[model samples]
Target: MAKIAFILLCHKDPDAVINQAQSLTAVGDCMSIHFDARAPRAQFDTIRDALKTNPNVTFATRRVKCGWGEWSLVQATLHALHAAVAQFPDATHFYMLSGDCMAIKPAQYVHDFLDRRDVDHIESFDYLTSDWIKTGWREERLVYRHWFNERTQKKRFYAMFELQKRLGLTRAIPGDITVMIGSQWWCLRRQTVESILEFRKQRPDVMRFFRTTWIPDETFFQTLVRHLVPERDIDSRTLTFLMFTDYGMPVTFHNDHYDLLLSQDFLFARKISAEAHDLRRRLGVLYACEGARFRISNEGRSLFTFLTGKGRTGHRFAPRFWETESTLGRERDLLIVLCRKWHVARRLVDCIRTSTGLPCIGYLFNDESCALPDLGGIQDSMDKRHRHRRALLRMLYEHYDSDRLLICLDPSNLDLIEDFCRDRSVTRLLEIDCDFSDRDLIEHAMRVGLAGDGTPPETLARLLPTIRNDMALETDTLRDRNFAHHSRLREADPPARNARAIAAFLDCSEPIAGALATTDQLFAE
Candidate 1:
C-alpha cells in the first residue's frame, strides 16, 4: 500500500533523465522533475515531451536557476516537492534524487524495504561534534551571511565574507532550531515532508536566515527534519550510496562499477556517468524485475575504503623523474632489500618468507612483470607509470595487514632507492654486498639498460656511499653487509644461513634450527 514520489533535480542529460522517469513510473511510482533554468531550454522540452504521456510524471512550474553552494538549489527542490504533493495525493513517501541517480535495486525491493520500516532514512549528524564536512567553512558557514554564489562570484563572495568578519558581523540561529548537517540526498516519509514544508511556512525568518547561509541545501532540510520529527522516527543514514574523494568531490560511477553497485545494500546510487549506456541498460533491467532480493556484499565497500581511505599513505612527495625528495612519512615495520642480482634478491625474499611467515614482494619497481603476484594479473591491467606504481605500493601495504613487509629493489633503480632510503617509514635498510666486480656490475647495468654510457657506473659507484650517508643521518637501523654475514649468505646451504641472519636481524625469538629446517622446504620450491 506504500507509494514513493521521487523528486529529481535535473541539470543536463535529458535522455538519461527520461529513461529514469519512465523506469520509476513503470512501477506505479510518481515522479516530479525540476530541470535547472540554466540548462538549455531544448533539453527541458525534450524531457517534458518524452514524459508527457505518463500520468505519473509531472514538472515543477517554477524553474529556479540553480548554482552550486547556493540557496537556489533548495528552492528548486521545494518547487518540485510542492508540485508532487499537489499532483500525487496518494503518495506515502518522498525520495529526493538527482539526474544522475539510478536505482541499484529492484523497484519492488525498495518499496517493500521502506514499507517494512516507518523510520525516515536520511543522513543527519550534529554539526558541532561530527567531522562530516571535509573542508571549507563549518561553524562559520552558519554564523556568517553568504550573499553571493561561491562558485560563480568567488571574489565577491570571499570579499563580502571577509568584510563581514572584519566588521564582527555575526548571526545566531533561531532558538527553536537545532542545526544538523549531512549529504544533500535523502528520503522522507510523506508526513515528515509535509511537516518540513509546514515549518517553512510558519518560520519565514528561519528560512531567510538559511538563505544567507553558505551551502544551505546540505543544512536546510537536515536541520528542519531533526527539529520537527521525533528522534525515534529517524534513521541517521542515507539510503543512497554516495562516495566522496579525500578532497570532498563525489566519485563518479562508470560502467565497470556495475557489479560493485549491485553489491551494495543501498537502494540507489548517484553521480553515474551519462555515457555509461551499458550500465544504465543493465541496471534498468534489474530495476524492473520483481521479487528479486538485494545482493549484499562488502567487496565494494572494502575496495572503496581501501582505495579512498586507508590507501592514502600521506606521502608528501609523489615520485617524479626530476625530483630527488623522499616520501615524507615513516612506514612502520617496512624493510627495504637493496641488491644488484635478481636471483639473490629472490632467494633472500624466499628465505625470509619461509622463516618468518612475513609478506615479501620481489622487484616492486620492475617494469617487466607484476610485482604483486598475489593480486593476479593486476600488472597487465594498469599502465607502467609512476602513479600506478605508487598505487600498487599502497595496495600492498594495506592488503598484507602484517607487522612487516619485505620489498626487494634493484640498486640500479636509483630514483626509487634514494627515495626509499630517505623515507622515514622504512625501518630497516639491508644492503647485500654480493661482492660483484666492477666489470660484473657494469655488465649487469648494461643488460638492464641503466648503462647509457659512462654515467651509470659513476652513479652506481656513489649509490652505496650515498645510501650509507642518508641512513646515518636519517635512520637509526642500517645493516651493512660485513664479510661474516656475506660469507654465510653465500654458503652452500645459503637458504639456512640467510634465514638465520634474517632472524637475527629481525630479533626473532624462534630457534635458529627451526628456521633452518623451514628454509630447506623453501628451496625445494
Candidate 2:
C-alpha cells in the first residue's frame, strides 16, 4: 500500500490542470497544486472550483509570482510540496510534476514499481564533469549572480553580468555542499522528502545564495538530494519521460505521438500540448482500462532510437518510402543544373524537358518564385528554404515517375551548390556559363534595380574559384568550363556554341538535338 502525493506547479491552461488533477484523484492519489500568482485570477478560481469537491485535491496557501529561469519556480514547488506533505500524512512517495504532465501508466503499476525500489528517482549529475550543459554558461551559472530574469529582461541581465565580471564580483559555492545539476522533475520517498524539507529549514544562507544563481529550480533540489541521500540509494533518473530539441526546448507530445508514448516505461510524460485532446483522452482510457496489460512494443522503441540518433546527427527530415527507393538505385537519375542567370536556367530546363520528356524543375531553390505550385508555402523564407532544401529535392525526385529528374539551382546559392556537387546521388551536374562579367552584372543590377538581383561582385569573385575547385573533384559528368575560351567563343558566335554545349551535356537524340540546335534564339543575350 504505497500511497503517493503529487506536487503540481502550474502557470496557465486551467483546463489542462483540472484534467490532470481529476485523473490523479480518480486513481486515489492525493495532490497539492500551486498556481502562479501572475496567472489570471479567473483561471485559478476555475481550477479550484472544478476540483473543490474532491477531498484528495488541495491548493497551496502560498502562491508565488513565477518567472522563467528564476527562483520563484522553486518557491512555488516548495509551497505545493509543503501543502501535500502536511495534508497527506499516509503518502509514502512525493512526485513533482508540471501542469502539462499526465499519467501514462496505471496507478497500481506505478505504486508496485516504487514499492519494489526504495530509491529516489531523479536525474542528478555532477555539472563540472558531465557534458549535460551543451550550449550555455556552465561554471559561470553558479559563480555569477543573475539578479534579472534572463528570459524577459535579457539586456539588463547581460549588462549586470558584464558589470559584475569587470568589477571582479564572483560568488563561491558553500564548501559543505556539492553543486549538482539535473531536471526539475523528481520522485522522492517520504524519508528523502522529509530530509530535504528539514535541510531547507536549517540552511537559510544557502537558499539565499541560490536565489541569485541562474535557474535555481533545476539545481536547488538536485544538489540537496545528492547531499542527503547516499549514492547507492538514488536512481539518478527522472520518472517522467521527457525529450528536448537541439535548442534545449522540450518537445510537446501530440496526437501523432500516441504509439511513441506507449513504448516508454516511464510512469508519466510532460509538456503535453493543450490541443492534444484525442491523445490525452486515449491515454487516460488506456491507463484506466489496460493497467499492467499494456505492453511495450519494439516498433516504438526502434522508432525512438532512429529519431534520437538522426536528430543528433542533424538529419531531421522524416524518412519516406522514396528515401528507401533512393538507397536502392533511384538516386542515379538525379541531375543538378547550376547557373547564375535564372532566365538562362529556365530556358535550359525547358529545353531539357522537351528533349528528354523527364521531370525538369526550374529555380527549385529560388527564394522569390518557384515553378512548383505546391512549394509556395516553403518559398517564403530563405532560411527555411535552405534548411529543407534536401527534403524538398527528394520529394520532387519521387513525385514525378521518370528515369531522370533535373533541378535548376542558382550558383549564388553556394551552400546548396556545394552540397549538390558533393552528393553521390547527383550523377550529373551541368554548369552553364552565361559569361557575365563583374561589370556586366553590376550594370544589369543598376538598370533593373531589385529585379536584377544578381550576385554581388565580391560574392561572384569568391564564388568562381570555389566552384572551379568543387568541379575539379567532381566526376567527368561535370564538363570543364574554360571561361576565357567560352568568353572568346561567345563573342564570336554566342547562340551556336551554347546550343552545342547544352545538347552535348544532355546527350540528346538526333531529332531532339536538331530541335535544340534550331532553338538558338532562346540562348540570345
Quote each prediction's TM-score.
0.66, 0.60
What TM-score would you give candidate 2 relative to the actual structure? 0.60
Candidate 1, residues 233-266, lDDT tens digits: the string is: 9999999988876676788898877766776768
Q: Rate the local accuracy (lDDT) of all candidates.
A: 0.73, 0.72
Candidate 1 clash pair list: 330-424, 330-425, 331-425
Off by over 4 Å in 2: 297-525
- Give candidate 1 misplaced runs (Cα > 4 Å): 305-511, 514-525
Error of 2 at 503 (Å): 30
Q: Rate residue 438 of model 1 by lDDT.
A: 56
Residues 139-230, model 2: lDDT tens digits? 88889999899889999999999999999999888889888988898999989988988988899978888899999987998988999999
